[model samples]
Target: MKLTSYWLDTVPRFTGTPQAALPGQADAVIVGGGFSGLSAALRLRQLGASVVVLERDRVIGEASGRNGGHVNNGLAGSFTDACAKLGEDTATRLYKVLNSAVDTVETITRENGIDCDFTRCGKLKVGNRQAHEAALQTDYARLTVAADPEACLLDETQVREELGSDLFSSGLLYPKSARMHMGRFGIGLANAVLHAGGLIFENTPMTGMKRTGNSFEMTTPQGKILAKSVLMATGISRNAPAWFRQRIMPVGSFIVATEPMDEAAMRRIMPGGRNVVTMQNIHNYFRATADHRLIFGGRASFSRSRTTTDITSGNMLLAAMRRTLPELPDVKIDYCWGGDVDMTVDRLPHAGQWNGVFYTMGYSGHGTQMSVYMGQRMAEAMAGMPDTNPLAGRAWQKIPCYGLASHFLPLVGAFYRAKDFVQEMKE
Candidate 1:
């Protein structure tokens, strides 16, 4: 499919130094150039390690550039669900790690002088139904207890006032959360990595990787990179190593960008221009861009291809938006696009070593913040300091379904969609 207008025309351009050819060898080699790989490279370079990054496309070409730009806190699942799956102590540690992750991204952007339009406007996880309200309340309590003192719950009226939409029954405002220009952010990080003396090779896809003795050899179309260690940060690309592909399923999610609107129009939808996501199983996340466009995103599909001119997904998202704000029915959609999200069976991100090669992906929709944190953690882990690592000895052990996610994702998606439909009907 041809790239959509949103992706083709709307994303910010990078004026950084041009990418260089793949290096012959490095101290550390990264397979992907999205948030995880670039962040990892930056941190590794800061630690005085020589690094090389291989990107299949130009930087910010896929999910990292195409998401809804919500720098959300915590994992994708509810805090209660996380605690249930990982236990209270483990889940609490994970939550703290992720909360700090959000701040880490902001700090990196600021310290490096990256102009990514990052704003700490907070995030609202809104409830769409009575049942959802109960879940939201429980989540609010759990998150408040797990969160810092600044986090608080917003009642229905407060949610309405904050979001300027009555569609939500309640909201849990994560004060530490923020929004960003994802595409620009990706470019900024790439530039930062380059400025720090790390090498990035654009349009260089990894064809194969093999573990040899104590090091890994990564083969690309143009050349091969041999390094002491390799990090796989390919979020949803099917071209990943076989062992890596088995653990994560790449589900496609679409997003639509409305024509630029005035501040009054934007405020009518998202008061304070804070990012908002509904509390549904198949949730919808939206945020106003720095350009005042309503970037509404949701609606998952199993299709592997997307058309630039096709507005079907965009129309569907607009209809969903109008269901909450009847005043915006005629809002013109300027761009529509889709990207793959790496989802795991347990709905938690996977970050660990596989086959002597370190890797991190499958954040679901929580990549914006968690990706940065995982990258930093992965760097620290590679530096021979596992005991003090944040992700060490956690409940993030490999799940049984990790090996089946890629093969059974369609069935899994259908089941989840059915669950979402039933829940939406109950609303």
Candidate 2:
């Protein structure tokens, strides 16, 4: 099966737009055309800075388009783990920043009139097994202590009522979270950036970047751009500058979208069309698309190759979905695909200056909201304000093994997967 985004193909691409050429010089240069790069371009333009975005492929052509489209709250790691790694004070600040990112994405979609099917439907973190439920309880307690009191918990009955699936024993509800048509959201964000007077060059791959004086020079096949500051938002591309590859590891995550189910069948699976993520170590994240298809995603591989035609591995994913809702045992998968997520070792995103360049990436699977928020933070930082805003300063300290782990991910990822499997069996 060819990897096609149902959400992306349903919407029209940005047509009749003028192609942007590489400028001789710019105030800022942003690499990657996904949510992070485009959002950063828009914010920087809003701040009256001359910005240019160079993308290797068409905008949202990778993970940003290929994801499951569940835009939820917080990072991939638990609050407790984050507190342990980053200390209590910094971890609390980071949670608040990510909490605000959920709202920031909503605000941008509405204010820009982007028809990306943005919805504030709450997310349910469901737990299937007893150990999973126990972990959720711990997570709930930690989040409760660090988050707004309004974010509450749900028992088994409430979980089933909300999700219409008996697989979950308990749930944690984060009211501030949301879901959007991720492909369309990325496209709309690019359009918003262009409308805001920023330059976006699609199909322009940044080959190399060199620091010159206080600025950076970025080279592409067709042209080159010199800028005062650069933002390297390319998540998983190994072709990224050496400095970027040091702090980020690209981990492959797969997603399979089922054929549109009948309205009655859809109602039976998800009552309110809310997004749900499981508590398993190799977790499953899913949601109902606007077209009434279930977008189920999970299972990670360390490979970087783009081969979307393996139905055997997809069967495992479908089986996982069946565990969540037995009613969907026979649902045919319409599309199966996978993309790489830039993961940091500690599971917290890294954002700060590398040498003289300002950059942000490595959101794990939590990029949907955090990418946009980090863009705004980058813009603020470039505007001569350096207070280490909530998200920026919290995780600036790189994990000890982040650099080494990212470079040799193919070897280390197997160990991580083994650990997850062992943990699941113990449960």
Candidate 3:
């Protein structure tokens, strides 16, 4: 199997890269050309701002391209617990904004006419063990009452009908969840930015930045830019701003894609055509592509990303896929890869200004849509619409005594595994 992203391999490369040398002056210079940075450029142009996007790699080359293509409108963690921790009013507002982010992604797909197979196929949060079923029911109860009236609980029999899998005991179905071809969406978003007269510099990394009077001066490998403001939409790259690095933890998420399967096999395993995710501290998510290929992904381990670990993770994911769907025997993995996901202490996205730089990060594993929303919001914030930011005025919590690498990941993974073992025993 190729150690590359199936999404990136399937879509055409973005050809509209800017050929001009980086301008000495721009209204805004965006760091990182993932979904957040690209979407921000599109919105900033609509607001009549001259924007420049600087990407260290190809646009959407990192976690944005390597993801499982879930535009799911759910929180990364439990909603009821979030309400209990932050109070219902605060949590409800944040939850609703994330739900709106899903709507924003669908709206963009429609408005741009991007043929990314954007589908509101809904989402199924399935329970692997018995106690997990109770948790799913709890999430269904709280979410339906708080944010989504379209959410509901499904028993084992109903889940079996929907998924044809005996591994899950129950599920929580969120009807607003969606999926799409992320690579195509990324290219489409890049075209949108270009169509709006924005400049994109692929393979250009921001090397340095300093305050120059009213504007910030950013030095890239190819050229430099002076901007009235800067947006740090950089994903979980180890080379990022110091302020951002302190608060964000880069966790490696791994995935493997099976070769295109027959329509009959797709129908037998996943009749509902929804994203299926099991409830676990270290979760496993699987869904079929528009081409009928099953893409399975997970936080296979808490260790940092490496070639060997990616292959090992792919093997583990294949085993999990078989356990979930015994009907798919001898499945051939066509692709395997890994990328870093930026996570926060609270596991919620934060958008605000640090010094002269506007920024957003900590999407955890739910960035597929929320990052896009934060991009639009960052544009609004830069255009004097600070209230548009859903995660406004939130303080970012930093990791203790760690920088760059998460040295304690294996210990954290072991703790979660032990907890899972205990939970399984209790069940």
Best by TM-score: 3
Give lDDT: candidate 3, residue 392: 78
What is the lDDT of every predicted structure here? 0.77, 0.77, 0.86
Regions more than 4 Å wrong, model 2: 15-20, 300-310, 393-427
Location of the lowest summed lDDT over 10 successive residues in candidate 3? 299-308
Stretches of candidate 1 above 4 Å error?
1-8, 11-21, 300-310, 393-427
Task: Look at candidate 2 and give me any clashing residue pairs.
Answer: none
Tell me the RMSD of model 2 versus the true structure. Answer: 2.9
- The number of residue pairs in model 1 that clash at the backbone is 0
**TM-score, model 2 to reference:** 0.90
lDDT per residue, candidate 2, 149-248, as tens digits? 5566788888877777776787887777789888778888888988898888877899888888887888999788898988888887788766567656
Question: Distance from true position, residue 18, model 1, in Å?
Answer: 4.8
Q: Residues 132-193, candidate 3, lDDT per residue (tens digit)?
A: 77777787788888887888899889898889777788888988889999999999999999
Indicate the residue-level lDDT of 320 in model 1. Answer: 81
User: Residues 3-59, candidate 1, lDDT per residue (tens digit)?
Assistant: 363643555665433656666789998888889999999999998999988888877
lDDT of 2 at 376: 84
